[model samples]
Target chain A: MPGTRGRRADARRNATAILDAAVECLSRDPDASVADIAQAAGVGRVTLYGHFASREELLDAVFARAMREADAALDSLDLEGDPRQAMVLLIRSSWRIVDRSRALLVAAERGLPHGRIRELHQRPLHRIERLIERGREQGEFRTDMPVAWLSAAFYGVLHTTADEITAGRLDEADAPGALTGILLAAFTPPGQPVPTAD
Target chain B: MPGTRGRRADARRNATAILDAAVECLSRDPDASVADIAQAAGVGRVTLYGHFASREELLDAVFARAMREADAALDSLDLEGDPRQAMVLLIRSSWRIVDRSRALLVAAERGLPHGRIRELHQRPLHRIERLIERGREQGEFRTDMPVAWLSAAFYGVLHTTADEITAGRLDEADAPGALTGILLAAFTPPGQPVPTAD
Candidate 1:
């Protein structure tokens, strides 16, 4: 029983290591080879293959892991205070998570099923949608646009920031502040004064 | 000499009509045939062929024409007032022109030279860049991000608004307001009060 339990624990550790390494390598270079990933993980290719079965499976695992981490970060934010501030916190965290995940997404998109990828993408939107609904109720965010449209608009801006950054027009260091500045003001209900002018 | 000049004028008018028709037809349907454009222009296929040797040439003409119109509309805006208000005016007009041209852009991207398209695109950005400079100097827009980056971010959001509408996520009527709000809020200098609180 001791030997059997130890083997299971070792298997879990190796699988986690492979996933972490896969994301790191694949994110940097979507075309990264399995051998490169296995080496990055410090595991033999055979051991990596033993767990993944194929690149497709490995991509699925990596996508799931990336989404899980993004969700965990989002979930950890204290969305309890001023909804605008809460949303700023939520989005800043989401930006960081999604920025890292975005590179891996290019790799995952080619190998993973489209439906699964879409479903994972919606979770974060739903999270934003709920916050929008809460903010509208609390009289923080604008209600003139539908909660759905506002959320979609916010999401669109969020992704576009990444595109602009990639195009070398936006500096990475300025992204979070720029994003908060843009979104926080937009979220204010139309005709409502923006909070706390200094 | 009079006869020859009259003939040349007639030919110029025909070319203009054909370009107008091509933009109207292609903007609605990118695959609109040469015959369709000729008919829309109140000219015959023979005249159309005489004017444009091939579809590629026709597309090039159509693209050049669209940029010309977009530029003219952008030029007409009274950008002499408040810098933020001037930008909003500039953007609202640009949005209408670009929204119409966006469809033509798809067809042009294939047949037109990339450099030509790039050159045409920069004209509007130059218009925006001048406005951003005025805004920053006037203490209206933020100075933390570079002028180029601010202009790029505004351009990105402007384009994203068109995308959301096409995707059915944003209503067309609500677009200008939503876009103006997002951009206006974002454009304000950090720590400054937004103009006109309700």
Candidate 2:
């Protein structure tokens, strides 16, 4: 029984490795093949197949894992401080996910049901919306634009930054500050002073 | 011959009216009916069908006409003065097209090949790119990010604003100033004094 449990642990570790590698490979190229992901994970094709039956299965696992991690990561951030500082913290943490997961998102979009994607987006969007609401209430953010629009625009900035990176137009290094600065200015009521990215 | 010329002018006027009304109705709602468009145009339903044989045909024509009008409108703007002022002028003109074409764009994306969409974007994107380049040289825009990134980000802002409007999260009246403030802040060479929206 001990030996059996040890083997189960190994299987779990292998499956996780495969999913992580798939995120890396697929995010770099949506066209990345099963063999490519397997190699990146340092597992043989047989080992990968032992875990996931097919490429769709692997992609689904990768997509779900990425979102779950993003959800948990974003949810865990201490968003209770000064609203602007909270936003800065949120942007810093969020950019890492955007940078790593954009390519994988491209892959998932190819084969997944759009309804599933939208469903997954709800929790994360609401989380950001609540933050904006707090900011708006405290007068730390603009009241002129709808809180949801500011949140939606923040998402837009992330995605646009991702596209700009893929197109070789934006450097990854600049994304966090760029996102923060843009959102801060956009969220500030027109006549109010815009905050600079620290 | 004079009578024939008069008939030709009437036909052209009818076609233009239908196209204009199609833009208005479709932008307000993508599911707008042909009857709705014809009525909005103040033309008979038969006249609308005579100009556009089918809904698909009318949508195609609307998309093309909107792009042409946008291209002409943007090209006619003088972009030679202060870089910030030029960008402000560009955003003002571009928002009109965005405000008009966004919902229609949703319909077109549903039925048209994407290559055509990318093709139409090129000229406008390049024009913005050139303006950003000028801004960078004059220290009016950040050189840290790519000129192309700023251009793409501007487009993202427009689309996001349109979506926000549709979702009832943004007001149309707030968009032009919102677009200008965000871009001016985002594009200003970071660490420099950010310009207030005029």
Candidate 3:
């Protein structure tokens, strides 16, 4: 039992290495094989199997890693700017993450069950909700709407922008600016009341 | 050559029938097959091939049909209500199109070359642009921002909402009302000048 525990620990380490290597290789080449990932991780076939029983498991691990990385990015982001600016930053950051992990995203899209990735999205939604409340209090955003609706719109903008960029209809350089403009136009408060020149 | 040309005309009819059947069938069942489509359309194997030559070709035709249907919806849509109401209608109508042709959409997402379907989107963009101009001219919408940005945001909300409904995250019935509130909140003018409560 003592020796078995030690082997399990070693096996876990090898699995992590293989998963990291798979994430890297898959990001570069979606069709990268398990052998290539094992080679990249400097692990033997037996070691790789000791960790992941099959290629599908290895790919799933890589996808989970990418999701965790994206989650960490969201968690560590500083959203201290004006509410509108903060929203823009969040969307842009999300696009960057999606772009960086496009291959894995495509794999997740095709292979994983629908809505699995979305379960990891609640934290980002809560953060954005706070920013929306602050913007409303600051008189910069509309106060009459529900936070859930705003959250949906925020997500909509992010997902649609990512799709546009992925489809090559939207230029990557212009995505952030364009999306910012859209969000601002939607959320910005009304200006000075101009009396009608009758 | 004359005989061949006559045969080709009949082939074109059969191909169109096959594509229509495929779109209808696929809209209901994404896994629908070539044989199913051919049977539904009452087309013989030889006739189906004389037009499509492959399942991918039939899929391409179906995607093209869906895009064309979307454009037709835009063209025929009455933009007569309050600008906000008109915009809401536009979103709802677009969502309905996607819902009705979800099978075709799934095929388009998987099989059609990316960006091809979006090209059919420009007509709706222009319509929304004109509507935004009307709202601004009526002093209901913001004048400082570009209409293009507003147009894109409108599409973004619709696309995102449709996707959520497809993925079963957002309730299908809630999409219209929720999106309308978000769009209106985002676009509505800020505070009217009044004495400060504080």
Estimate every model's Cα lDDT from 0 to 1.
0.74, 0.77, 0.68
Model 3 alpha-carbon drift over 4 Å, by segment? A1-10, A29-60, A76-114, A117-123, A126-149, A166-181, A184-198, B1-6, B43-50, B77-89, B110-116, B119-153, B184-198
> What does candidate 1's lDDT look like per residue over A1-198, in tens digits?
559889999999999999989988997887688899999999999999999998888888888877877877777778887887788788788888766666675576445653466456666778889999898899877776656656666666666576556556668887787777667776776556544321
Interface CA RMSD of each prediction in angstroms: 5.5, 4.0, 8.0
Task: Name model 1 segments beyond 4 Å from true.
Answer: A1-73, A102-120, A190-198, B1-26, B29-68, B102-120, B195-198
Q: Please identify which of the two predictions, 2 or 3, would achieve the higher DockQ against the true structure.
A: 2
Steric clash pairs (candidate 2): A27-A104
Preferred candidate (DockQ higher): 1 or 3: 3
Compose the digit string of candidate 1's lDDT tens values, residues B9-40.
Answer: 99999999999899899888877889999999
DockQ of each candidate, alpha-carbon based: 0.20, 0.26, 0.21
Candidate 3 second chain TM:
0.77
TM-score of each: 0.65, 0.66, 0.69
Q: Which residue pairs in candidate 3 have backbone atoms (N, alpha carbon, C) closer than 3 angstroms, thus clashing?
A: A186-B186, A190-B190
Give the per-prediction TM-score of chain B: 0.79, 0.74, 0.77
Report lDDT (Cα) of residue A14, candidate 3: 81
Residue-wise lDDT of candidate 3 within A12-107, one digit each (tens)? 878778887888887677777878988999999888887788886777777777767787898788878777667667777876887677777655
